[model samples]
Target: MDSEKRNQNYNTYVEAKVPKTKFWQALLKAFVVGGLICCVGQLFYDLYAYWFPTLSEAQLGSAMLSTIIAITAILTGLGIFDWIGAFAGAGSVIPITGFANSIVSPSMEFKKEGIIFGICVKMFSIAGPVIVCGVVGSVLAGLIYLII
Candidate 1:
C-alpha cells in the first residue's frame, strides 16, 4: 500500500478502537465532587471557628486550608485520592486538595531515590510552577494596586 493509504487505514483503525465519552455524565460527576470537596472545607472552617472562638477569620481560614491539605496528602499517600480523581475528573482537580495531591504524589513516587534528590526535589515538580505563578501574580497585583 502507498504511504497515504496506509496512514488513512491506521487512522480509521485507531478511531474505531477509541471509547466514546459521555460528556454530560462527566460534567455532572465533576460538579458534584467539586461541591462536596468545598463543603468539606466549609465544615472544617466552621468547626475551627466554633472551637477557637477568639481566632480571626483569616486564622480560621488558614487552619481550615491546612487541615484540608493535610487530609489530601494523607489520602494521596494511601492511594484513595487516585480513585477519587479517576471518578471525579476535573472536579477533584480544581481544589486545594489537587494541589496537595500534586505535591505528595510525586514525592511518594520518588521516595526510593532518598530524601534529598528524590523526595524533596520531585515533591514540587508539578506544584512548583503553580506556586511561582501565584506568587508572581500576587506581587504584580500588589504593585498595580499601589500604583493606582
Candidate 2:
C-alpha cells in the first residue's frame, strides 16, 4: 500500500477504537464532586468559627485552608486522591485540594530515592510554577492598584 493510503487506514482504525464520551454524565459528576469538596471546606470553616469565636474571618479562612490541605495531603499519601481525581476530573482540579495533591503526589512517589534530592526536589516540581505565577500576579496587581 502507498504511504498516503496506509496513513489513512491507520487513522481510521484509531478513530474507530476511541471510546464514546458522555458529556452530560461527566459534567454532572464534576459538579457534584466539586460541590461536595466545597461543602467540606465550608464545614471546616464553620467548625473553626464556632470553636474560636474571637477569631477574625481571615483567621477562620486560614484555618479552613490548613484543614483542607492536611486532608488532601493525607489522602494523597494514602493513595485515595487518585481515585477521587479519576472520578471528579475537573471538579477535583478546580479546588485547593487538587493543589495539595499535586505537591504531595510527586513527593510521595519519589521518597524512595532520598529526602533532599528526591522528595524535596520533586515536591515543588509541579506546584512551583503555580506559586511563582500567583506571587508575580499579586505583585503586578498591587503595583497597578498603587499606580491608579
User: How do the residues 1-148 of candidate 1 rate in per-residue lDDT, one tens digit apiece?
Assistant: 9999999999999999999899999999999999999999999999999999999999999999999999999999899999999999999989998999999999999999999999999999999999999999999999999999
| Residue pairs with backbone overlap in model 1 | none
| lDDT of every model, 2 decimals | 0.96, 0.94
In model 1, the runs with Cα more than 4 Å from the true position are: 1-20
Predicted structure 1, TM vs. truth: 0.84
Per-residue lDDT tens digits of candidate 2, residues 1-148? 9999999999999999999888998899999999999999999999999999999999999999999999999998888999999998989988999899999999988999899999999999999999999999999999999999
**Residue 70 lDDT, candidate 2, scale 0-100:** 98
TM-score of every candidate relative to the true structure: 0.84, 0.84
Candidate 1 lDDT at 98 equals 91
Candidate 2 global CA lDDT score: 0.94
Error of 2 at 69 (Å): 0.6
> Model 1: which ten-residue window has the lowest total lDDT?
91-100
